[model samples]
Target: MNATTDLLPEWAQRPVSDEFLQALTARFGSQCSTALAVREQHGRDEGSIAAPPPAAVVFAQSTLDVQDAVKLCEQFNVPVIAYGAGSSLEGHLLAVEGGITIDVSRMNQILSVNTEDLTVTVQPGITRKALNDAIKDTGFFFPIDPGADASVGGMTATRASGTNAVRYGTMRENVLALEVVTASGEIIRTGNRAKKSAAGYDLTRLLIGSEGTLGIFTEITLRLYPLPEAVSAAICSFPSIEAAVHTVIQTIQMGIPIARVELVDVNSVRMVNAYSKLTLREEPMLLMEFHGSPTGVKEQAEMMQEIAGEFGGNAFEWAERPEDRTRLFTARHNAYFAAVASVPGCRCITTDACVPISRLADALLQCVTEADASGIPYFLVGHVGDGNFHFGYLIDPANDTQRQQAEALNQQLVQRAIALGGTCTGEHGIGIHKQGFLLEEAGDGAVQMMRAIKQALDPKNILNPGKIFQLQ
Candidate 1:
């Protein structure tokens, strides 16, 4: 067993019975697949977590289809895991306990576009990029991009945030409403198209970052932003990571309203340069974006340049054209893949640590020192404007020592972030990988409350069981 699954109980790994399989087949003929290929596709995600694939895969194309399939799982007392674009970075998609995975990629569609209200309701399977493309001509766009073409369901499930989160917000802030399937196969809608409501409990907020443990998202309503009138992207190189990070801290403290600000360490800069075939300076760099009216964007850029200059940042480069901005941001998004390719046949154990803006330098630099001293090859990148960063430690799957070393480094990072008044995971939800840390960060009392809520909502323990926390 892998590190992620070793601690799970054997009872949770219940085998899928022929009775259940036959019932599932009878419910949906061709959509129900027991093929190894289909099971494998729905079994894993982008993380290093490993587990046996589910016994069967259900392709749910509509809300009724999801409701019916879930009802069958409920009847059989079997665990049900939701599947989307499969871009999750933590172990959110792994089937630690043997179960059936409901793939929602086929359900991708835009249900409604209300330009007047600046809101869009969509099926759970639509990706952020696809959503933007569908509404590009409407003069509005969704800004909660998590660096991947992650499905809206997965993003909402994890409460994901990305480079633009500094200005707009994460899924927690932008998600307005949801249509969810409860463990009992009941469809429930929470919140509405209207912005703010003080009517009793905020179930919408409760389910946003629950990581599919409480319910499965069938439809989501998101707040949209009008396209920025004027936008500009820039990159500035710094002598060291400290300089680059400090610039971000200052920019945020001064209220610059920078749209997106990302930090790429020297290792990542070199890797992305090689992978993207660009001749960028191999130094710690800050990639930034500004949005507003023409004058406001210009003013923000000028203020940022002055702050960067104070920290000895140099070689300010601008990418003003739309194509140029895409090229720069695309390279930033591919940094993870570039790091993986740096070492042949290597997988990554990534760390997501977010601290208060004032403590970011200490949290980041200390972690960097430990990583460098441990001799682990890794790439460093962050949406530093929001004080969240990731270190992708490349590890050979066959080397036990390397894997342990990476885990130790990750543990150290998490402990440090918690000590500094931060979270173990900034955006990546508590999947199988970080359950232990979730207890450490939130304490037993709070975690028990969460467990209580989970138990109340999913009495059968069939909704993505064995995630977030292990039921006692």
Candidate 2:
């Protein structure tokens, strides 16, 4: 083994003995995996970096099973990495110090939906799409959409958000409560079903974005929104990206309650159109959605059009038909994959930075100009309504020069974001990818407090070690 691998803790390095595997198999039956390949596959997430495989993979089917596994790991001094759908962009699910990967996909079930209370309880492994589909006939919707069909557990862990975050807020806002298994094998519910409370310590918020460093989520209670009376979608083209961004800024300043406001650059538009088999104009465009009463939506759209005109934006192409709107959004939702597919054999180094609304256009222009000069293939997309955007740098990983350039660009972006009174990461948690940036953003005193909290909750550091904050 390499020196880096050799330096891992004893429990992380020691192989899963045949005797232990036999015992696990006897206890969990068909839920345990002893194969090295299966264990390795379960260890890593969708992050660009590769990680060491877990010593074992346990397909947990219930809260009792998760509690049992946690207790066993605690007794054995083994680290536990909670595995959901493995769809996280950050290295949230990577088993850096190999131990056990508790696969929660089998626990996918919606426990209950309290439409009157505007809340739902579900097992952690349930995907957002599954929950939405289940509640579709109830006239309620869960709006914490992060584009990907990620598990509720993973979404809660990462505190994820997407286009609609401008209106419905993020997981931090929607997750009403969580059922988590602590390092000591204790299951606790952090919050209640009430609308508001002056609860003690706010533990729910602490675990929502903990990224499995403090506890393994077993269940989640999330707030849901009633279906809108009327929804309108539109695609507005701009002569330049600055115009589109300016239009968004002005629209927000004018108090338009836009449900979603997304920006797709010319290159991104081209890729999505080709990948989705559509004939959209290859221009810098803004995809907007307004939700409210019919009169309200119409008024919002009209006001937004006037603001766009001021910024040299074209007339809004309204997707009034339900099918047309779905078609448009379907293409938008597949933008990341489309951009990735544009370059054969390319891995995407996606990163995002948020800035103050007034400084957004400048920040985006700077990053786009730098990317243009870097001679690297990239596409830009943003939740411009909230001054947050992501740049996908499609690079051949084997090319050292390209990888280095991409890293440099990412660093520059973070630096600019910090300089503009913004965060290095807006919605994505401070997983391994953004750990260094966290230090840069949150000062030494703030970081020390975070470390204190982590140490207090996970003294042994057996839960998701080497993530978020490194040891002193």
Measured by lDDT, the strongest candidate is 1
Candidate 1 lDDT tens digits, 321-386: 999999999999999999999999998999888999999999999999999999989999999999
Evaluated against the true structure, the overall lDDT of model 1 is 0.92
Clashing pairs in 2: none
The models' CA-based lDDT, in order, is 0.92, 0.86
- 359: Cα error in model 1, Å: 0.6
TM-score of each: 0.98, 0.95
RMSD of 1: 1.4
**lDDT (C-alpha) at residue 120 in model 1:** 98
Tens-digit lDDT string for candidate 2 (1-472): 1111222342235344566656667779889886888887787665566677888889999999999988877776678889888888777777777678899998999988999999999999999899898999999999987888899999999888888998998999999888999999899989989988896889999998889999999989999899999999999999999999999898888778999999999999999988999988888999999999999999999998888888888857999998998898878889989988899988888887988888998889999999999999999998888888999899897887887788889989988999999988877787877877888899889999988988888887878887787766
Q: Residue 404 of candidate 2: its Cα lDDT?
A: 77
Candidate 2 residue 82 C-alpha distance from true site, Å: 1.0
Error of 1 at 406 (Å): 0.6
